[model samples]
Target: MPYKANVVVRYKKSVLEPQGQAILLSLREQGDESFLDVRVGKYIEILLEAENLQAAEEKVRKLAEDLLHNPVMENCSITVSQDD
Candidate 1:
């Protein structure tokens, strides 16, 4: 009965995140080789209830870009749905 918004935030695959690689190495050293293959990335999902799809989409994108993600190192995708 209302508009909903979803935001997904993740690191750019091309960025070299040494920290993530280090964590993977640590996992391997600890003998959890299974975790060694883990490719670390950030993913965030947000749901917004707004008066309209356009508003919800705009609000969520602003929130993600301004507050939730590092604009230089990360990127976000947003989707809004309304069937009211």
Candidate 2:
């Protein structure tokens, strides 16, 4: 079976995000004031072949916690879906 994993990485609310602020400023300057309060984060989608959804989800969660995110100042969420 094939599984798709989505990893969303974001800085903790208590952490200051300079990159997100910079991007937000740039967007505002470009006349997208609608994004004035928007916070930017990293998004990644991956495809994997696994024996089952549970296994795929476990692997994806570890990948997010161990390699995809900085546990020190970031929080990560992962979702896994099976492909029929």
CA RMSD, predictions in order: 3.3, 2.0
Off by over 4 Å in 2: 27-36
Write down the TM-score of every candidate: 0.62, 0.82
lDDT of 1 by residue, 1-84 (tens): 366666666678878777788988888878887763445555665555787767777787778777888878877777778744
TM-score of 2: 0.82
Candidate 2 residue 22 C-alpha distance from true site, Å: 1.1
Q: Summarize candidate 2's per-residue lDDT along 1-84 as a digit string, tens digits.
A: 899998989989998898889988888889887875656789999999999889999989888877899999888888899975
What lDDT score goes with residue 36 in model 1?
A: 36
The parts of candidate 1 lying over 4 Å away from their true place are 1-4, 30-37, 82-84
Worst 10 residues of 2 by lDDT: 32-41
